[model samples]
Target: MKKQLSKIIKLILLTCLIFTSMITQPATADIASGAKIFEIHCAGCHENGGNIVRRGKTLKKKALKKYGMDSLEAISAIVTNGKNNMSAYKDRLTTEQIQDVSAYVLEQAEKDWR
Candidate 1:
């Protein structure tokens, strides 16, 4: 009875460990797809993260933070609805593609457009 109880306890602990690892694992995003989308849609004005049309509205971290667009949701909204000089991409891109591009923009912003 004692040996059986010990085996059961070990099995429970191992199960918990496996679950914890699975939950903690980081999920990867499709940055390359986002890059392609950006190239097709945003590169004309934002080449190399440089905003020629609007110098202060570059994709760099400072510009994003200054314009209250430092998060993925904010960027996604802008992409979905469009703002000021930018045209809405809601009809052109699917919801998932918008999300992917938003994620990519945030990732690139963090990397300083490198």
Candidate 2:
């Protein structure tokens, strides 16, 4: 009985460790799609994270910082709504596309900027 209980305890601990690692893993977004979207839509105003004096601000992580929303969802909403001087993209882009692009933006921005 004692040996059986010890084995069970070890199994439980091992299971918990695996679960923890899976949840803590960093999930990233697609860069190629994001780059395509930026080029076709946003690059004219902001290129290589530079020359965006008129378009309000760069879509980089730092620009999104003012809204206090860093998650993929928040960025998606902002893109659809077109905050401030930015034009709304709701009619232009699909929901899934927005989400994908948002995730891509986060993935790139964090790696390249913040």
Candidate 3:
């Protein structure tokens, strides 16, 4: 019993240490990557940071109003499958890129919209 308890304590401590290190590192948000992808690709249709009146609806207010999802998941699905007049991006973007870009859109909306 003592040996088993000791091993469990050590495992917990090691796990905590690993988690602390990960948290301490300068972690970048996936949104940053998504923003880059959007700037390069989606910006053409949707416009960067803000939405376009000519082509598509603005993502800022409309997204929160229409979909109760987080900006990240919303953007990823839009990028992957598209909606309405928008074209799907599953063939063009990788899963990692989609997640990153989704995050990026939220960041952009935050920075540019408000």
Candidate rank order under TM-score: 1, 2, 3
What TM value does model 3 have? 0.60
Mark the 10 consecutive residues where model 3 has the least summed lDDT. 48-57
Q: 32-94 in candidate 1: lDDT tens per residue?
A: 888999999988988888888878889899999999999877998999999999889999998
Steric overlap count per candidate: 0, 0, 4
Clashes of 2: 0
- Local accuracy of candidate 2 as per-residue lDDT tens digits, 11-82: 999999999999875355556777788778776766765436654366567766765657777777777998
Candidate 2 local distance difference test against the native: 0.72
The reply for model 1, stretches above 4 Å from the true place, is: 1-28
Worst 10 residues of 2 by lDDT: 48-57
Candidates in descending lDDT order? 1, 2, 3
Pairs with steric clashes in candidate 3: 31-103, 31-104, 34-100, 34-101
Q: Local distance difference test, per candidate?
A: 0.88, 0.72, 0.70
Candidate 2's displacement at residue 14, Å, is 22
